[model samples]
Target: MAKPPPQPPQEPPQGGFGAPQDPRSGSTDGPSGYGYPPKQPSGQPGYGYPQPQGHAPQTPPPPGAAPGYGYPGPPQPGYGYPGRQPYGQQPYGQQPYGMYPQGTYPGGIPPQGGRSNQRMMIVISAAVAVVLVIAGGVWFANSNDGGKDDVAGTSGGSRGSEDGGGTDPTEGGGERPADADAKAVLQVPYPSSVPVDSMLVPGQWATAKTYAKPSVYSITGYHADTGKKAWKLPLDGQVCASSRHVTADGRTAVVFQERKMSSDSSSEPCNQIAVIDLDAGRKLWQKKLPGDRVYSTGLSLTISGNTVASAWIGGSAGYSITGKELWKSASYRGCRPRGYGGGKALVAVTDCGSGIDNEYKVQKIDPATGRAKWSFAAPKGLKNVNVISTDPVVVAVGAGSVSTTDIMSLDDKGKLRARLSLERPEHGQPKYDPNCRIDTESCVTVAVDKDNLYLPSEEHQGKSQYGDTNEIIAFDLGTGKPKWKSDAGEKRTILPLRMDGDTLIAYRQPTLDSGGQVVGIETGSGKQTVYLRLPNETSESERRLAPGYGTGALYVNGRLFMSRDSIRKNSTYDKELALAFGS
Candidate 1:
């Protein structure tokens, strides 16, 4: 409900496709017109299952209807996937001006309030334990410019006992020091000559032994504990789409182009899919989809069990991890599978029809056979569906004109349990926006566990006029009510990465003086624990990097990994390919 304290101007992001775009400032620069190609009458829902017999006739939503506004009524024919029917179309398209934009928060933290004395004591102990865990290896140096713009080795450098490179001179590639733990910090420099049109560098994965990410046309693994290059797997062309899911053994899938992109030519097709083992650093198998079809440059690739599924504008197909063809589903009945969400279960989101006739369906899919286990049809006129989680089954939906207005939680069957309103938070409450992308599973700022959904409150002005702050709120999945909320403390903001057991692992954005931190919030109690305190020395660098667009942040095995989603050619500023921090 308040604006952040005023701070120094942040440099605009270096130009490139999928470059980080922080939404806290309300900046609207992005791919034009919803970031998807226009669909024709015969066109696909850029991205289904079956059930029920003919029942009641459907009533189309009124013109200018928006979710949580004038729109009302349960999904027609109830919730199950519709069998082929002659249900007519309804004209719809009204934007909710209250919905927040997609992306990360780039605002100052707020002053502490609203917590009991007991909770304050718990946070204090956790902070002390974090410092003790890192021991003598880390320090928070003083900053003259409020910690903004100071490089690690410059005159205002905030690091202690460090060189300009952000690494010890004697600590070349070798065994990680026993002292290196979650508090350790390292950075990888950006590759030179990356083309602006290359479009994407889209995956981030971690193993106990290595931290791996795509750098332009190659995938490289770095020693997890020490910042040493372990292995690099070069590709024939730049990576286009990648699965955020990884197999237990550290293997993942990526789709790349057949030939290197040329600056003189239009973008190349992303037609080749490959499975790479991150720990061992080798491609297990690579194959091209059958037929040319001029596949959409942005294909949705995901892994569920041993099968890797891909969907695009033309159609959808499945493949084994060993590269065996499983099954393929072509468009049928004016509906096309657009993308997939993979994990504990495989799920697919399909778009059917065009314009007011357009409808989106979320289906629980069979990983191996390409059959629909069950399907849930979203209300007509809500054009986009982003699967936030597969197991408990949470989805964020919005109308054609906005990013997201509500979140729907469903049961194991295709029935909807509750719909959480994002467009209409309680009065005085900060507006909620997950900033979900067009893909099925690309809502990066939101996370869900079995019983509750977690999202960050939009940053607002703090009690002080000097800065802004926010909190993470959890909602009960069954009733769609607020369960608890946790603050990120003064001058800091936090985003949920994922679940580490019952604890919610979150990253506290760096401030002008303090480096970013890794925090664990107990789900039931809403208690906060500071697990890792990064070096104040590199706070400026850490502040410059926040997860948004194709870029991301991950915490696993006590290490924090961040990567720029893409790189641009002829940039005025230097940007790192990726940065890793650990104890």
Candidate 2:
């Protein structure tokens, strides 16, 4: 792929965790390994699961073993509550993302090349997942230094968490918006949602982890119907795509991002986190992930109730949204972080010299202190059982192979109560798209309620454009019994985004030619109740028939929120969003 055409640098305000560190330019004035503590093992010992009988002796797959390299095979979804669309924020100390080489798509759009999917996600919990949109492509790592730095606004570790003061502004009192169709909403400025001009470039949004850049990053609250920017709050780092949320209370938000720092000409990559108390319209606290156990802080940045937790290479740690360190621990040999149960339980994988041959135990720890309380060991063959959910006790699941997986629900005391099996896509199929479950053989896209668990079926295999069925299979959580299969088997298949109450919110494939509808399906039985056909641009790109650059539709309360962020087909990401809301 050719590099993007160079244009004169537009000097903008310097924003984010600090200054930009594009290693490609040979400027190494940033932090790389500073402030990081040495790795230490957890205090617990000899934690093992009873091996299952009659199964091939398991061992972690050898290097270069399987054709796939994503989140530990099938069944492992990017961490967090099963349906939160999160990527593990375990900060496993993976090398920093590479620079975007100079390249431009002939059509001004990146060519839809064959990029390999996110083959392996080594981390704990859910907070920052790469939404791998698997279309055809080679898995290449590169970034674009399309920005020039200038000092702007005030931020970085230098800013006090309480800088916003007691005078709050955005929406501090836990109140919803007055407009019936609009809920609490926020829009962060540029670089927050960078465009992958060419499809060949890995689709991971550069916005998720940009260090200091040319523009001051910001979050602006907007009036629902008028498209007015109500208020703007500045921050020092880019927001992680997987960990951005506008809560129901309308008063708070959690922003996750990666940062690089330098001391004495040596640089280190670190996780920059902040709690944006919307009411104050300023940050409550802004700090680097703390504690010796919190290595790789960005790996699993999850917010469960009042607590926020991070899993990393050194270990996993929990914190209060106010920036208080609640607990931390060092994970022993081969043990990996899983998910947080919000004051209920914290789960992690244990005993894996090699993930396969070993009988992996899934241990539940005290949410406050990282102390091992109980463990549910996997039966033989079901290696490396990763805990996925805590809302309803513990749902530990693992991929037996690329095509098969095992899902088991364990009781509070670590007793295996039920198990189920599901099918998944092969190594290089389109479903491997990060958007399709972060480029894994399978995605942990199951939606569970008090009584049932809903899982979307793989996009119908084979030729597109006809007879393709996109489905959500519902199963009883207690008995692991199949309930019903709801599908959108129409001309243009719809994508099931998430579960809202007893209904499923789905968006029809957007096209340049016509408007699209946000369809609401009944979870009990696959029935379409609400079909709101939106404006043409609600899902379409300004220049082509394809879906807009960062297009996605979510159903909130009585309104449908559609966001389209693109710089190619359109001049700016914000305009696309405002245009989509054209009333």
lDDT of each: 0.56, 0.34
**Per-residue lDDT of candidate 2, residues 83-158 (tens digit):** 2111111122111110001110001111110111121222232222222122232211112121212111111222
Off by over 4 Å in 2: 1-220, 224-226, 240-268, 291-298, 330-365, 379-388, 393-406, 424-445, 461-467, 511-513, 542-553, 562-583
Residue-level lDDT tens digits of model 1 in 1-583: 6533322212211121121133343433321122221211111211010100010001111224321111111112213322211101011111221121211111111111111111111111001100001112111111111111211001111112110111110112212223332454558876777664224576688777888888777898888879788999999887777888777677789888787766523346667889998889999999886445423332588887677888865567777777877776444446666578887777788666553344567777766666666767665545467888887888887643335656777778766666665532222121555646556777777778888888776665556444456677777787556767777777676777787557787777766666777787888867777777788776645644565433567776777788766555544343576878876
Worst 10 residues of 1 by lDDT: 123-132
- The C-alpha TM-scores of every prediction are 0.68, 0.53
Q: Candidate 1: where are CA atoms >4 Å away?
A: 1-184, 196-198, 294-298, 330-333, 355-357, 425-430
As a TM-score, model 1 comes out at 0.68
Q: Alpha-carbon error at 477 in model 2, in Å?
A: 2.2
